[model samples]
Target chain A: MSELLKIENLHVSVGDKELLHGINLTVEKGKVHVIMGVNGAGKSTLMHAIMGNPAYKITKGRILFEGQDITELSVDKRAKLGIFLSFQSPVAVAGITMENFIRTTKTTVSGQQQKVFAFKKLLKERMNNLSMDASYAERYLNDGFSGGERKKSEILQLRLLEPKLALLDETDSGLDVDAVRIVSKNISEYHNENNSILLITHLNQILQLIKPDVVHILIDGQIVREGGAELADEVEQNGFDAYRLAVKGDGNDEA
Target chain B: MKEIAINRLPVLTYRYLKTNDTKILFSAPQVSAAADFSDKTYVTVGAEFPENFEGASSETLAAALAGEKYTITIPSGMQAKLTIEIKLENQHADYAGAYHFLLQKGAKLELVWKLSGTEAAQGSYLASYYELEDAAELKISKLQADLAEATLYDQRFFKLGKAAKADVASAELGGKQVIVHSRGALNGDEAALTERTVYTGTGKQHLDLFYHIDHWGKKTVSLIDGKGALAGEAKKIFRSTLDFHRGCAGSEGEEGDYAIQLSPKAKNISLPLLLCTEDNVAGNHASSAGQVSEEDVYYLMSRGFSWEEARRIIVESLMRPIVDSLETSLQEETLEEIRRKLDAKGE
Candidate 1:
């Protein structure tokens, strides 16, 4: 396997406050990596920093995609370069239909205009696979959508964009058991030999459905432990209290 | 040439802001002629103006400049559709016209007005008056697509009787300077009126829009909704008012203006007012003028769209509802004009 993404000693900040301390991680192609952490452990910040969200500024270190430095690329440029982020809370945009929005995005990424009929057929098929209502195609993008539906919509985009690296920021947070199953199935289907996934989650429901190649216990913006898929089960059983106490002990010693 | 103030606000404001009224240079054009239309039995090409006809700008100098009038009368219990095309020729020319529509009891009419110009620098003044009797219905659609160097003055007035209803949709997509004034009177019980206007401004375009609706009958209802986008150095001022009279008990009125500014130098001013004298009446008003949300832009950008492409999509989406409401041909024409103004290619 070859490395698909590499983050070396990354430091991120929002406004005047530093959020993500120096962090290092790497994901190989055809691999699924899971990050388990408590609330405020800089999980979302790391995801956003990787996706080039302007709100999260990188003060130190570099991000290498396939060994090319992408630390300064804008969000759109990064997206074009095959980086995708499944937002925990997607913004609702009125006026543009779901079909139109997706079609335009596909055209932009693929550098080709999509035929209306063929694109509609593909969209309908994909929507059917997700168990989404056919009428959602004509509805405004994410407007008035329920929580589960929004999650499904995010997964739908994940399946359509097919980026090389998908950074999911707690995508399974607000879903029911059934919804989680559907989403996990879609995510599993989207992952192939040529793609990678870096998912952040607090629940084990999704982990049970799609096994992770590597699980990293993130405590205080740093990956404190890394192991096989059993690491996730260990965290689920023991929780982040042990890791939090260990970090506190180290801090007390430094002070 | 002379100067006259038109589209004056019903209530006075600070004198320095100049939002109280608009002043324009006016001179009657020598090339006055009837508009092109397919003549029907109920339509009169060169009809005499009704004695009691009153326009929204009747109190202004616009009433004095009206010329070349036409009238259409829909008989009782009848349905009719009419289309009128007005074209202006010659640069630096001026043209003015008036249209009168009367729908008798239980009559229904669908009216569409198209305005265009061949010359780059011209002026046009149009006044449209509608009077619907008891239980009559009217649907009016107007599309204005003149040259960028032209100036247009559009005024409309409505008088709806008992149980009558009127719905108006206007798209202003052209002209360097456009001024619109509209007024409606609900004088009978259960009468309703809805006016929706959408516009787009680019370059150095200037748009002054005003709408006033009065509820004077029991259980009357009125809604004035305006939506538009401004790009480049465009400036737009929107003023809307809804008044509920003392005798108009159980009346409801709502007015709102929503604007999107697409450029740093663009300016948008919106003022929505509601006045009610009846204690039992319900009145509401809202106005919003701001640039597109940064989060929305970021959301679109994250989907592989460049910043410019994302902004264009958002702006087009904002104006899509009203644009889609137009007839098929008019919809295409309006969209083309919008694309040209935005400097974007067709999708």
Candidate 2:
């Protein structure tokens, strides 16, 4: 398969402190890649750095998308290029209805004028499929949404935007078993033969639903182990203690 | 000097003057009583106040010089809605008028005033006095626009009887120079007053507003809310004061101002002062002004909006609530105006 995203020796910092130190990875087109790590392993930082979040500064390395360098693009330009990031904790903006926001976004990305009536029909169908309330469209985006509802909202966007590559940060966090099943189903449906995914998650519940082709054990900002999907099962069973020790030059690196 | 300054705004160029040249006509209407103040082209209402109404000297002077006046009364247990359209043809002159109103016991009224006419480089003044009897209610919604070439000066005084309530709301989105001054007093027990305003301006516009509510009766309440948005090089100033007297124990008052400065060149000032001579009273003031954050911009950007479109979304959110408060026909008309205004984004 052809490559979709590649990060070469990426180094990033949050404020005065460095988070990711010379990390490198690549995702093949149409494949789902999973990153498993402990807390403070810089998974979210790497995701933000790749998405051009100004809070996370890239000190070194380059990002290549579909074989072209995009390290200097702003977040919106990157989004226009079809790079999507699902925030772990989406900010609730007051006074912006979901219908207006999503419709405007669809117009901006597709370069087509959206008819409100047709858009509402499409939105209502998608919402019904996701088991979301019809009233969600009229309410302010993420304002007063429950944790599970926010996760569903993220997946709803994921299904609509249909980006070439999606970096989902903790898409399964704060979800019940039923919510996880719904979100995993949506994520699985969103990832097809034409798109790729890099999922940042520590839970095995979502992994069981949407199998990853490649699982990378990221420890201390570096992918210490790259292996098949079985690598995730090993971590779920043995924990990341061995990987934590391996980052300190004790355990052997598995490639 | 401005009555208040936010974010270290520079000293204003226009000085705060205690006087203007707009005169009020004190003569009673030649038209018959009980006539409705409804039609657009004709106005027959006149000042219903006494010839020697002992109150504001400026109001009295404006009344002494006013060429035309209007007054409409709501009898006890009655209600009415008054619509007035102001037309100014003067050049470099100060246009003034006095709208006298009285609400008898248990009466209610909502006065919707629309200001239009000349966009010339002149000054306009409107002075109004309201006397609400026991348990009466009065709401005023003022809409003024399309006068970018003129300066505006408006002042109002209100007296509340026992348990009376007065709600005043104004939307001022016009004129390069505008000033508003309002003062009120609660004379009887448990009276209340609510004053709310929304202002939007672009280009080199200037809007200055002042409000003061004094409490004299026990357990009275007063609230002042200000919302303003500015783009381009426009500037706005808000000054509010809540004073509680010794006999006004258990009174409560609050003042809040929210401002959105879309451009770095825009300026907003808010000063809310609270004075209390009573021991048992609650009063507070809150004010904040700023532009949309890069984070909020990026949040919308991630969905496909450009930086400008994201900013427009945030700015329009501030105007949605005000537009929702209008009547059905006016609401649709106002929404069209707002959509056009949003499309003409500055800053």
Candidate 3:
């Protein structure tokens, strides 16, 4: 497999506080990478940094997408280059309907004007797959959606945009059993030999459906351990306490 | 040319702020043309103005400058649909017209009005009055999209009788300087009035809008909603009042003004007022003005829209409710004008 994304000693900060400490990771084409951590372990910080979120400043290190440095690119520019981040908490933007928003975004990213009728038909089909009601197409984007519905809406964008690299931040956090199954199935279908996915989650429930090729244990803004899928099972069986202690022990030794 | 003070607030404020009233240099136009109506059966060429016709603006000035008048009377228990178009053709042209509508008891009317003009047309003054008897209903969709160089002065009055109701949706999208004065009086028990206005101002355009609704009978209801956006060096002042007079027990009134400022230099001033003279009445007023949300912009940008495109989309969204309320043809035309003004720079 070829490398799709490579982060070299990435250091990220928010305001005056550094959230990511010299992190290094790589995602290969056709592979699913998972980062599991407790809350405040900087999982979201890493994903945002990869997507060029201005709020997450990269104080040091560089991010390369398909070997092209994107450390200085704006969010829109990075998006145009086929990097997508499904927000943990999507904002509700009233006035623009879901159909119009998706069509506009797709047109901008695909560099083509979409026909209204064709786009509507395509949107309807995709929405049906997600079990979203047809009326949601005309409703304002996530204006009054329930939590599970919002997650499905995010995945709908993920399937439609079809970006080369997708960073989903806890897409399965708030879903129930059935919704989780459906969302996982859709995500599994979206992944193929030509693309990659980097998923961030604290729960192992989602892992039961979509297996991760690699799992990294993150603690105190650093990766404490890296292994195959069994690492997630081990963490689920025990907890992150052992990983947190190991990082703390390492810090004590350094001190 | 003469000078007159118009659009005075019902309650006085500090005089230096200029929110109390506006003074404009006015000249009566040479052209006098009647509005084009879709159906002529219920229309008459000339009609006597109502004895108690009161507008938000100076009623005397509106009466003195009026050049043409058309009246439409809907029969009792009947339903009617009407489309009226007022177009000014000449450069530097001026026009003033009066329109009167009478709906008998249990009558219903759906009216759509379109006002347009040439690129360099000077001024247009329109005064419209509606009188609805017991249990009558009226629905109005008004679109004002004249050229950017023109000036517009619109005055509307509504007198609703027992159990009557009126719904008005107005879209003001053009003109160098636009002034709107709308007033409604609910004189009968259970009468209701709902007026929603949406506007967009670009370049150096100025918009002065005032709306006042009086609840005089028991259980009367009134709602006034104003939403708009401002760009460039444009400025807008929105004043709305909901007054619940004595003997209007169980009446409820609500008014709100929400605005989005698109440019740094754009100005938005909103004043929402509620007055109650009866102890059993309910009234609420709210006003809010702010810039576009940074988070919303960032979210749109993540979808590959530039900063400018993101702002435009958000503004369009804010204006969508009113734009969608227009007729299909007018909807497209109004959207085109919005896009043009948004794309233009330093106009």
Worst 10 residues of 3 chain A by lDDT: A246-255
Q: How many backbone clashes does candidate 1 have?
A: 0
Which pairs clash in the backbone of model 3? none
| True contacts recovered per prediction | 0.63, 0.59, 0.71
Off by over 4 Å in 3: A112-122, A245-255, B1-4, B13-18, B23-34, B63-65, B246-252, B278-284
Q: List the residue pairs that clash in candidate 1.
A: none
i-RMS of candidate 1 = 1.1
**C-alpha lDDT of residue A87 in model 3:** 88
lDDT of each: 0.83, 0.77, 0.85
For B1-347, candidate 2 gives per-residue lDDT tens digits of 11322111112233453121212223211111121246423234577654433222344335323634666578899877767666544442345666677889999887787665456535555677788999999988777776767666676778999999998877777676776777889888899998888777688887777788889999999999887677889877787888888999889999988888877898877777788889999998999899877777777788777777777777666666665554344555555554555467453
- Model 3 chain B: lowest-lDDT 10 consecutive positions: B56-65
Candidate 1 lDDT? 0.83
Which predicted model would earn the best DockQ? 3
Q: Mind giving the per-residue lDDT tens digits that candidate 3 earns over B1-347?
A: 67777778889999889888777666555555446888888888766677666654464336433667778999999999999987766633667777789999999999998888777677777888899999999989888885667778788889999999999988888788888888899999999998988888888898988899999989999989888888899999898899989999999999998888888999888889888889999899998889988778878888899888988888888778777776666677777877777778873
lDDT of 1 by residue, A1-255 (tens): 999999999999999888887889999999999999999999989988998888899999999999989999988988888988898889877778998889888888777898999989888988888889999999999989998888889888888888999999899998988889989999999999999999999999999988899998888887777888988988878787778777777433211
Comparison by lDDT, 2 against 3, better one: 3
Model 1 residue B140 lDDT?
78
How much is A23 displaced in model 2, in angstroms?
3.5
